[model samples]
Target: MNPTLRPRRLRQSAPMRRLVAETRIHPAQLVLPMFVAEGIDEPKPISSMPGQVQHTLDSAAREVERAIAAGVGGVMLFGVPEHKDAVGSGADAPDGILNRAAAFLAERFGDQTVVQTDLCLDEFTDHGHCGVLTAAGEVDNDLTLERYAAMAVAQAEAGSQLLGLSGMMDGQVAHVRAALDAAGHETTAILAYSAKYASALYGPFREAVDSSLTGDRKTYQQDPANRREGLREAILDLAEGADIVMVKPASLYLDVLADVAAVADVPVWAYQVSGEYAMVEAAAANGWIDRDRLIAESLTSIVRAGADAVLTYWAIEQAEWIGARA
Candidate 1:
């Protein structure tokens, strides 16, 4: 009654499973997304996200050092400015909080890891929209492009090696690419948030960035129900000269991630977003699931779905686990 060939042989032992695993995760393939807020002199804990914090400039540097020591690939920076305005003037200012942090990181750790900045206006704008609005309160697309172009130059000037174009504005990639080149920032790269969906999993993130959203972002962000549209957006970003493309809230959109990865010539990354991380922490806090194992499993699933790299809150811990396993 015994089978002649047993597939379970590979899954029989931990070592066997490790050795024969088709997908693997490494420290170098993980990127940690961090927040640094103005008006906070200390690392402020975020309640929705149990283990995350809004770090001070110095604390942020210390955290990045830990990430480097753990061999995490990169750090993505988001800024929570002290002031908000109709036009998000702080977003591209030379002395803006985001720009200052970008310059600090680039100056301190340029040779150690990639320095990336979120090129979005939501955290700076009073309306909490990704772009400027007209007198009628509708987002102005072409005018938004102008703001993005200026932000691109500003970020480049601050030494951001990778600009995360996450605003979801039309023609954003082309506009930013032309702006960067015209300003002689030819080497700074773009990581387009190509398949970002207007998902319900961004609640914790809104808190993370101190978002002052007036209305839903459905006007710009893609609908979660559209699968083909995800790939279409990625293709458009690629055509517009994205050095890398990413899908946000990665786990819920494996199909979209795979679709983009299938056609993308550059590296494909995914964001294991704040809400996704918070859900796991909440479950683990209630003793409902094994914490460490699920973190590894969640990340592995995203990579298996075709992500070349992942931006996760667990990047440091996961990298440590990866090293311990090695």
Candidate 2:
């Protein structure tokens, strides 16, 4: 190594390293995903997810206030309906748990921070699939589009600024966008879960939502083995007018995240899924790792991989850490 070109100078001090850092995580770049369930009088702990819980409407609102106070960029809401049906009728019901909670948050906290919703049927459906199924139990792509389009309007009416299309149905983004425009909710944006993978990391999530999944989502969600497909999905979603695009299971898919970020004209985001969080918590519980340090590093790694924003369970805590450090 050339002594004249030594990089050690920048590493000599904390302030010097901070000054030369290429990537930074911000409170506004973190979005916390919340689960609000029906029939729950109190916040019910999601055992698999450790500290997370199925919050009631009022409890969810209070939690959102804390996240907003910490300067988190947004909160993504997932509804857990008490009732499940073949067509997931509760998904678009005006008074359904999800819509009810969404409205509650939007009315009170919309001005304070971004309010987003998971516009999928998994939580409301008895089959536990992301969309409606046919007689043979195969997911009906076109049929699900109709449901999603309706859900879009419903969520928009409930004041969701961003709709997270995580179902992975072909043409979902386009179909939902057309429906929103026709319904006069043109400003409601789509955050396409463009490269959501059929990863094993979703096990804790299913528990959190009380999922009664019929089988698997492999038929819709992308396979984790394909690298190019991730970017292709993002491109397709962008063509369909997605306002923002996301890659799920962030840590393991940095290459894909980078590929999408490199070419995307719109903001690119990543989801640090449940399994990833669980692993760290499990390890930290065993005293194998520093819990807080690993959490911060995990988030920093995702942002460094080209995500403009990150959907993380630790968003609020991360923001507080940032605030304390400042």
Candidate 3:
């Protein structure tokens, strides 16, 4: 049998397969998102997120060190305080858990890896809203911006190089950026969650943060049905001085991630949210799928979709796997 084009010939060699692979995952493209509880002496396992924990300050530092050793790009830190308030005073206090975590990470691993912290009040707010409420029981968009600005300054002062504005309030990026620059933190960067949709995927995260949100976030967060609006938000954030723009729930929003990445002049990132991670892990635990293969494939798919970086629960393990292959 004679064939005009022998496609199998190229496929026959391992080196050919490598050369033709269009998408590859790297350790440096992955970021680990961690949670730290203020008063805990030991790490507490989050039942919803298997094998993940709410770390103590000491344990959080150890986790960051491990992530660095694993060659992960960075760590997104969330703090769980023992108290809550209407104004989320914990978010602005230099001695607060989030600030302490930022300071500790900066002091220890500032030169080794990028230190990022959640700059939102939901975890500290009694009502579980992103900001202080008004006389009316609504999550005030303008009011939230003020809180976000202060949170940004606090996080920056505590040594956070990147402020993750996850509050979903209007003009959040611009507000945080102005506050940072006004405080003489010209080097502080904003990673705006530009396309965050109000999704149930955040259930585990809410639990991890001990949030008691009284109502849904539909008031401020974008509805999942609006694809064009997602792009608009990303563009607006870029114009508002975001160094990096991100789409949340990466697996479910790959199209959004791709679109943003295509038009983005700066780096584009995605957050593979809690629900997506739990789904994969649950399937693997039940012997329904190959865990490592699926994890690598999912991360590779995000990369192929044009995400410059991915924030994932599997980041540490994924980084180690990619590094080992290298």
Candidate 4:
């Protein structure tokens, strides 16, 4: 073997590997996705996602504090209301659970952590769709944009520093951005779920949010087979004033994530969605894989694929692990 080509030399020691490592996962690059449920007396376990829970309002606040203590960069909040309606009216109501949770977190953290909200209607809609529906039972794109705009202002007024626009609606970013600016929320940011695919990987998430969705969201969300389309969506979001663009179910869409990251002018994020997390957890629980190592490897792979940040359920735990290793 040529001595100069001995790559194993760097891999021979832990310190050498660390020094030569090309990709690293940092606590500051991780964002935790949390759910706060209305009418919950305690943190309720999501059966599909073991070790994950839907927190009560008070518990949600404490979880945010814990995430901050663990050094995670931010928290993305989702609200599960006790009631639902055709138009998802609660989503934009100032007293809505999600809005109240956002207000509480922003007030308590006060710039100590980035408080983000899920600026979508799915959790509040009785039909479990992301937007308003038409008479023909289809998702009304233009009409939904109006609802999204209203929701954006509500979330911003509730003190969310960043809005995770995950509804996959057409013109959603532009609408939300304009509404925010018009409402004097100029500093609020939008983290667009630019390339969210209509994947079966969202099963656990449906449970986490107690989704009433009877059918699929394929009409709105991107198709998993189209890589170029994902990039196009990201580009559109960037042009529409998204501060960051994201690809959901990151492990299954590394190529898409990479493409978005390459063309994105701002930060590009990837979401390790519910199903991805559940698969790893199930395997680890059954002694089929190394839990902590797999978690670290998955996140590192996402970073290596060019994501600037990752939204993951294991964020806090993984952040602590990274800190211990450092």
Q: All candidates' lDDT scores?
A: 0.95, 0.94, 0.90, 0.93
How would you encode candidate 1's per-residue C-alpha lDDT over 1-326 as one tens digit per residue?
97989898789888888899999998999999999999998999999999899999999999999999999999999998999999999999999999999999899998999999999999999999999999999999999999999999999999899999999999999999999999999999999999999999999999999999978999899999999999999999999999999999899999999999899999999999998999999999999999998999999999999999999999999999899879
TM-score of candidate 1 against the unseen true structure: 0.99
TM-score of each: 0.99, 0.98, 0.97, 0.98
When sorted by TM-score, best at the front, the candidate numbers are 1, 2, 4, 3
CA deviation > 4 Å runs, candidate 2: none
Error of 1 at 90 (Å): 0.2
Candidate rank order under lDDT: 1, 2, 4, 3
lDDT of 2 by residue, 1-326 (tens): 55788878889999999899998888999999999999979999998888999999889989999999999999999999989999999999999988998899999999999999999999999989989889999999999999999999999999999999999999999999999999999999999999999999999999999999956789899889999999999999999999999999899999999999999999999999999989998999999999999998898899999999999998899999999888
**Which runs of model 3 end up more than 4 angstroms from their true locations?**
1-10, 13-15
> Number of clashing pairs, model 4?
0
Q: Write the per-residue lDDT of candidate 4 for residues 1-326, one digit (tens) a residue.
A: 54767768789988998999999888989999999999989999999999899999788888888899999999999999999999999999999999999998899995799999998999999999999999999999999999999999999999999999999998999999999999999999999999999999999999999999989999999889999999999999998999999999899999999999888899999999999999999999899999988998999999999999999999999889888888
Which structure is stronger by lDDT: 2 or 3? 2
Residue 28's C-alpha lDDT in candidate 4?
89
